[model samples]
Target: PPDDWREACLSNDLPEAGTLAVTLDEQVFCLYRVEGATYATADRCSHGRGSLSEGILEAHTIECPFHQGCFDIRTGAPTALPCNRPVKTYATREADGVVWLNTSPRDVAGQP
Candidate 1:
């Protein structure tokens, strides 16, 4: 396991193509499963206080229930109106039936 990785939950705990919210070290994160792959991001929507875990999951995107804004689950990039700022993302993976979440921010364009 990576030094910053922490066990989040069992892989089977997540519904297929859905979202789950988990708290680590007092921070909330939304976990997602899409096409057998897992992803993680800050649970709060960048545009509002809406909880991403309660929002709609569509393919690789999550739609904020507050304003109907959408974000790409893979990169946390906003993909719809009312959500221009990118949400914080974390590196996530599934191994041995367990889902692990990296405490460090996900690297994007060589930036973290």
Candidate 2:
């Protein structure tokens, strides 16, 4: 569960054309502040086990640094071929000047 969950950034902490990786609750979350609100997903690419934190973000998608795989930031669904596996994603919400991620108390692979 999210205990006393607090702020992640001041919205501008991450650029609109890039991403930011932050460790929260022992898990790595890759935050994409694209366009307006922020989006978050597990920092690992499910397909080749690539570190998504090291990938290049394209709009609402992330290109895996290891295998050039692409996944949607909003749903963590693989958008490119050779990487159909979906990564764990978290719910995002913005309050004040900060962004918050909700890592539900469920397995990432079995997330609803």
Candidate 3:
């Protein structure tokens, strides 16, 4: 395992093609599983500060429930109106039936 990778949840804990909210080191993260791949991003929407985990997940995008803003789950890029700022994204992977998250957040340029 990578030094920065910390266990977030068990693989079975996430529903297929769904989203889950997880807290690590007092920071909230939104976890998503789509097409057998997992992704992680800051749980809060940059624009409305809404919980992204409580929003709707569609393909590689998540729509903020509060203001209907959308963001690309992979890069945290805002994809719709009312959300011009990118949310933070974390590196994630699944191994040994567990989902691991890198505590360090990706840069605003979307580099991990």
Candidate 4:
């Protein structure tokens, strides 16, 4: 693993089209597996205190459990009502059966 990346979980632990909630350095994050890629975002819903990892995952969107507000898992964009603010998105990658996350927020182009 690279120095800037932190292992979040074993790749097998998060199957395809699944969500995983993880905490590192006292911060919570939600990891998702869509298609064959992995993505990470703030676990808390921007519109409420609901845990996004517990929400439903539809295509590339994650619906908040509290208000049913939806957010794009890839870009963290608000896609539904009651969620006007965007959640912070982190960089993620999977290798050697381990899921790694770059806690630092990445740019829209996916560059850190």
Residue pairs clashing, model 4: none
Higher TM-score: candidate 1 or 3?
A: 3
Lowest-lDDT window of 10 residues in candidate 1? 103-112
Which 10 residues in a row give candidate 2 its minimum summed lDDT?
A: 103-112
- Candidate 2 local lDDT, 1-112, one digit each (tens): 5563546667778777778888877878888877776878888788867888789987888899888989988777789977887887777788877888776522445353
1-112: candidate 3 lDDT, tens digit per residue: 2687889999999878789999998999999999999999999999976999999999999999999999999999999989999999998889999999998998877777
lDDT of each: 0.89, 0.77, 0.92, 0.89
Alpha-carbon runs more than 4 Å astray in model 2: 1-4, 105-112
How far is each candidate from the true structure, as Cα RMSD in Å? 1.8, 2.9, 1.5, 1.8
| Model 2: lDDT of residue 63 | 93
- Candidate 1 regions off by >4 Å? 110-112
Error of 3 at 37 (Å): 0.5
* Weakest ten-residue segment in model 3 by summed lDDT: 1-10
Residue 17, candidate 3: Cα error in Å is 1.4
lDDT of 2 at 61: 84
**Better candidate by lDDT, 1 or 3:** 3
The runs of at least 3 residues in candidate 3 whose Cα sits more than 4 Å from the true structure, single-residue gaps closed, are none
| TM-score per candidate, chains pooled | 0.93, 0.82, 0.93, 0.92
